[model samples]
Target: MTAQPNSTEARDMAYHLHSYTNPRKLEREGPLIIDRGEGIHVFDNSGKRYIEGMAGLWSVAVGFGEKRLVEAARRQMDKLPYYHTFSQKAHGPVVDLAEKLIGMAPVPMSKVYFANSGSEANDSAIKLVWYRSNALGRPEKKKIISRIKGYHGVTALSASLTGLPNNHRSFDLPLANILHTTCPHYRTGAEPGQDELAFSRCCAEELEALILEEGPETIAAFIGEPVMGAGGVIVPPEGYWAAIQDVLRKYDILLIADEVICGFGRTGNMFGSETFGMRPDIMTLSKQLSSSYQPIAALMINDSVYEPIANEADRIGALGHGFTASGHPVAAAVSLENLAIIEEKDLVGNVRRLAPHFLGRLNALERHPLAVEARGIGLIGALELEAADGAAAGATGARVGAILQRNGLICRNIGDSIAFCPPMIITAAEIDEMFDIVEASLGELGQQAAA
Candidate 1:
C-alpha cells in the first residue's frame, strides 16, 4: 500500500536522502519508519514489533532501550555536555574512555584516538598509516591494501579502502595508491579441486604477489575485517589468518584490523582479533562500542605505529588532524557506561553460552529450499539463498528480507545472503523466536515463489 500523504513515511520520502538507498525507489516504496525500541525489539510507526535481527545495522550490542546508557548520557549532558580534544584539552569522559579502551585492547595498544563512527575511525587509520609512513621518512610506503568485498566506510578515503565495486562506481573513488587483494571466503574463491588449506595459501600468495608487485617497501598497511560483515558476512576458512599474517610479517607490513562489526562479543570473543589471532599494529573499532546509543568509535595504535607519529607531531608543532566532535563528552560517557554494562553483565559470556543455539538454528537453514549456504559465529549469521533462474542476483534474497521483516524479524541482505546479528542481551527464548520467524517467513517466501 502507498504511504498516506503527510505521514512520517511520506515526509521522509520528500525530505530524506537515505544512505545506501535509491532516491527514486523511495518515491515508490517509502521507508519503514521505526518509532521506538526496547531490549531486542523495535516497533515501526504502525506499532508492529520486530526482532531487530540485524541489531540496527549490526551495532547495538547491549540492545535497544538500555537505560544505563541513557542515564550515562543524561548525567554527562548535565555535567559536561560538550568539549573538544584539540590541542591538549581533555575531559574526564574522553580521558576515561581512552584509558579503558587501551586497557581492553586485544593487543598491546599504546594509545587510543576517538572518532564519531566506524567510517571516520577507518579513514583516520588510513590517514595515520600514511602519516606514520611519512613520519618515518618513508613517504613511498603509502599504499594500503584492503581485501575485495571489504566494507570500510563511505568517506572518500575509507570508501577507497572498501573493496565493494558499488562504493567506487560513481564516486570515481578507490583513489590512487589503494589496492585490493582476494577476499578470504574459501568456499567462493577456492579452485575446483582445492582444499581449505590450499585456498588459504592461494589467498596469502595473492597478498604476497600484490605486495611484491607494488614493492614491499611501498606498501604501508593491509587492512581487513576478521569476518567481512557488509560483504555478506564472509568468515575466513581454517588456517587463513595464520597464513595471511605470515605474509604480512615477512613483508614487514603493518596490519590494520577493521573490527567495526566483530568487536564487543559479536564474534563469540571480546574481539575478533582474539578469535582470529590477528596481531594488528592498528585497530579500528565502532558499532557496538557505545552500543549505538551514542555515535562513537576508536582507533588504537601500538608503540611501533605511534612513536613515529608522535615524533612527527612534535616536530610539526601540531598533528593537524582531528574532528570537532572527536571525543564528545556525552558520547564518551555513554560509551564508558556501555562498556561497563557489557562487562558487568558478562555479555561476552552470554554470547558464548547462546552461540551454539544461534549458529545451530542458522546452520539448519541449509535444509530449507531457498538456502544454499549458512555461515555464522556467535549471534551473527547469514543465509545465502538460491535465486530463481533468470532473476537478478539479489532479487530472491531481497524478497525474502521483505517477507521476513513483515513477519516481525528484520534482517539485512547482501547479495544472496540475509544476515542476522541480534543484540547480545537477547535471551535463549528470544533466539528461538527470532529463528522461528525466519523459518516461517522463508517458508512463506518459498510458497509464494512456488505459486
Candidate 2:
C-alpha cells in the first residue's frame, strides 16, 4: 500500500517528477526521503541509515555533509553570491578553479569552459566540435562517434552521443551526425575464443570501418568514458584506448573523454584518462568536481581545439555561447574547497590504499550463485548477475538489487549488473559492511529463485 496522504511521501508524490524513474510506480510506492547524511551514509526521514554504495550516482567523492564544502559555499555566498561569465566577465573563484584544473589535467589542456552539469558540458562539447570544424573550413566534418553502452549525458546532443537505448527510445534522439560503434566489453561482446587484445583490435577496426563508410570528411570526433559508467559500469578491454586512439589519429578525429563519472580519483588515479591511457583533445568533467555539493561541470579543450574557435569568435564578433550560471561563484568556491580537501587529505591515496580491499571483496562476490562476473578497478566495481535459465534478462538482478536496498545498501542495478561505488572517504570496515549486505541480499535472492 502507498504511504498515507499528507505525509512527506505523499507530498513528494503530489508534485515531484523524478528523472529515470517510473512515475506510476513512484506515485504508488513513494520516495525514500533522505533527511540527512554523514560520511558515506544517509538516513531516511524515518531515521533509517543506509550505506551509499553507488556514491549517489557515482559522484560524491568526498561523501556527504562535508562541513568544509558547506563553509566554502557560505563564504562565497557572503562575499559574492552570483555572477556571470558572459561578455568576458569573470570571477576570481571561477578563474582559480579553471587554472587549477588545467594545471592538474593528465595532459596539457589550454582552456576551461564551465557548465552546470555533465550533460551541459558534453552538450557544449558537441557545439564546440561543430563550431571548430566549421571554423577550420571543414563544415562537413561534424559526425561524432560514441560507443554502444557508453553514457555521456541526458541533454539533447549529449543524449544522442549516449549509446544506451532507453535514453533514445521515444525521444527521436540520436539526432543527425551521431554514430555508435562497438563497446569494448570483451567478456560480454567478444566471441568465445577471441582474446582481449584481438577484441580491442576488432573494436578499433569497426570504428575505422564506420569512419570510412561515412567518409572521414564527415567524421568530426569520437567520445568515450575512461570506464563506462551508467552502462553497467563497463571497464573497457585491454588496449582498447590505444587502439581507438590510433583510429582517431588516422582520421584526424577529435577525442572527447567523458570524465563525468571517472574524474576526481574514482579510479584510483586523479583522472580515469591517466588510468586508461587516453590522450583526449577535449575532456568533459563533472559529478565529483564539487563532490556534488554544488552543481558544476567543465569542458577542457587543448590549444589545438581552442585556437580555431577563438579565431572564429573574433571573426564573428563574439564567442556566441555561454550559460547564465556558467561559472557561478558559489559553485566555484565549493569546487575549489572540494579539490583542496582531496589534495590535503590525499583522498586519491586513500582510494589507492583501499582499492585492494574493495576489489578483493568485489571479486569474491563471483562465488555467489547469482554472480556471473565481478569486475572493476579502484573503489568502483560491478557484480553482474547471471539471470536464471528461462528468466527474463535483468529480472533476477533487479530483484536482487531491490533486496539489497531493503537491507540498507543503496546501489544501482544497470540491467543485471549491480554497481558499487562507495565514497572515497569510506574505510575498509565500511567496505566490508557494504559487501556483507550485498552477499546477504544475494543469498536471499538465491533462496527465492530456488523456491
Name the top lDDT candidate.
Answer: 2
- lDDT of all predictions: 0.92, 0.93
Error of 2 at 392 (Å): 3.2
lDDT of 1 by residue, 366-406 (tens): 99977889998888889999988899999988898899988
Off by over 4 Å in 1: 1-5
User: Can you list the residue pairs that collide in candidate 1?
Assistant: none
Total clashing pairs in model 1 = 0
Give the range of the ten consecutive residues with the poorest summed lDDT in model 2: 2-11
For residues 61-180, write the lDDT of model 2, one tens digit per residue. Answer: 899999999999999999999999987789999999999999999999999999999999999999999999999999999999998998998998999999999999999998998999
lDDT, candidate 1, equals 0.92
TM-score of each: 0.98, 0.98
